[model samples]
Each structure stands twice: as structure tokens, then as C-alpha cells.
Target: MTTPEPDSQVGIVLVSHSDALARETATLAGQFAGPHARIAAAGGTDDGGCGTSPDKVAAAIEQVDQGIGVLIIPDLGGSVLTARLFERPSAVVVADVPFVEGAIAAAVLAATGAPLPAVLQAADDARTYRKL
Candidate 1:
């Protein structure tokens, strides 16, 4: 099989209390969305502790940005608050949806070259998704 062409689509960032969780989730989202997806992880404190860091989050956002908007999915607690700090009316958006599900949904939609609004909508829609 041949590789797909890279597209300038919305990026995704996963913020979590544990660095491992965020990194693994980003990997899962990237894998599901294929190699062209832009996903980053901003988890834990800068000192390798259990917490969130604005600096780390900002770096992740920069790492994945491709002139398009980005979607930030925070795990919970302070991570959500930190994620909100980067929210912008056009270039950046924070999705208040389930962490893993939202990341996967956002990444998948973004990989298809969807716009920020569409990617955000898909992530939000994942909140109502039933897995029964």
C-alpha cells in the first residue's frame, strides 16, 4: 500500500495528569487517524511530577500547529483549566468532552482534512456516543 498525502488539517493535543497517559493516548489517536495526523501530548509537570503545565501545553500546541487551528482535549481537573488557557476564538479550541474518545474523534476527523469547527464538533459529539 502507498502512503497518503499530508494535509494541513486541524491539530490535536492531549493533556493529562500523567505524562504516560497523555503520550499513549496521543499515540493511539495518531495510530487510528493514520500517519498524516498531527497529535501532541502535554501531560504532567515540567519536573516529571503528577500535574499539568502551561508551558508544556503551549509547546505541544506549537509542535503540531500547521497554520491551521488546534483542538485541546484535557483529561480532568487542573488539566482542563490549563487547556482553557490556550483557547482562542479562531486558532485554538478546547473540547470539553471525554478525554480518550474526544482525542480519537478529533484526530480522525482532522486526518480527513476537516476544519477546526468540524473537528471540534466531532469531538463534542463523542460525548454522547454510547458504547453498549
Candidate 2:
């Protein structure tokens, strides 16, 4: 049996056009995400090309899902479309927020053991970030 905890666990899945960009962004977020942060990058085509693949996304979600829940962030329009195409488990949530910034916020909150809803809220809040 697992130990009972008060905080809700949530992981993040980043879907980007470029594999390197996705991994690099994940690394940047992981810096502040702490050890417990679960961030997965599902990018590029199945044949090692640039694009999002539903297969890759499903696999990424499976890898990151740690029994709590998952938040999906997509980089481009196609990436978002691909994320939407994949049939996810009930616990999956797709947040409409800036990909990089949202991932950073989500990673930080998730690292602190915040609940799934809280994490998604934080990511959604990232849309207000000042780009000026």
C-alpha cells in the first residue's frame, strides 16, 4: 500500500514541434521543478521529423502519469491538434496557456506537490505573463 498524502500529484506533458526545443524547455523548467517534478516531452514525428505525433504523446503521458494526473501543453497549432486527437485517460487535462511559460509555472507548482487542479490553474494563469 502507498502512503497517504494530502497534496495532489500531477505531471506535465509538453508537445512541441522540435524535439530539442521540447527537451530544452523541460530542462529549464526542471531546474526550478525540484526532484519530484515529472515533466515529459512528446515532440517530433515518429520518423524523426519535426511535428507532433499522437503516438508519441500517448506514450509520453503513459510515462509521466504517476497515478495522479497529467497536464498537456502543446507548442503550435498542429501540436495542439495532435494532442487533442489522442484519446487520453480520464485524469488527463489539456490547459490552454503559453507553452514555455505555462510549463515553467506548472513544473514549479507540481514540484511543490500542489494538487492537479492547482497546477492547471497556475499554467492557465501564465497567459497573463508580461511579454512587454
Candidate 3:
């Protein structure tokens, strides 16, 4: 099988119950990936609200899923649900990693032209160390 080429415009999106968490994660990921990486984020509102809509997540993924790659880090419940709703292309990866650090790291790796599998593996490594 031919391996897919690495994505150059790789981006990361965090879906969480708090907008701050999402934004913070995006910022942290930017630090790791540097100023040029493409990172985006969205969060669920409080007051017993549904987190960012699945469509919004899908849109974000679509926006970044160019030939490069796109990685999505979801908080919980809604975040995972939103990711699950999409039919991810080979160029896009949706990870259920709940921690910001791990997600950010994964995004950074993806942004640096790492393959999706490698980036996901890094995210999983981060997830293992995160204090859930």
C-alpha cells in the first residue's frame, strides 16, 4: 500500500467543555509547533450546554484537512461525539485525547509534517502521562 504524504498545513482543534481550555490548549500547541503552525480550537459552553456543535468541529477539520493534515483533540462526551460524527479522510485524524498537553503535543507533531499515525502515537504518549 502506498503511504499517504505528510500534510504541510496540519492543524489542531480542541473541543472541551470550557472555551478557555480549548483556547489554552491551542496556544500551548502553538508553542510546541512554533508560530507558523495552523491551530484552531472550539469549546462547549457552560450552563449545561452542548459543547461546540459537531458541525463546527467538522468544519474546522475540513478547513485544515488539506493535503497536509488535521488533528482534533476532544475533551469528553460531546467532543468525542462530534469527532465520531465526521467521516475523516486519510488526511484528517480525530483523537479522543482529553488532556490539553497531549493534544497540543500531537498537534505540534502533526504540524511539523509527521505522519498521522506518528502524531497520534505522540498524542497517546502524552495522554498516558496526563493527570486525567
Clashing pairs in model 3? Answer: 7-68, 8-68, 44-51
Stretches of candidate 3 above 4 Å error? 1-7, 45-50, 130-132
- In candidate 2, which residue ranges exceed 4 Å CA deviation? 1-8, 87-90
Candidate 1 structure, TM-score to reference: 0.95
Candidates ranked by TM-score: 1, 2, 3
lDDT of 3 by residue, 43-110 (tens): 76544365667656766676666665667778877677776666466666777664776776786677
Lowest lDDT sum, 10 consecutive residues, model 3, at 1-10
lDDT of 1 by residue, 10-129 (tens): 999999999999999999998989988899999999999999999999999999898789999999999989999999988989989999999999999999888999999999999999
As a whole number from 0 to 100, the lDDT of residue 89 in candidate 2 is 55
Q: Identify the leading candidate in terms of lDDT.
A: 1
Model 3 — TM-score against the truth?
0.77
User: Per-residue lDDT for 114 in model 1?
Assistant: 88
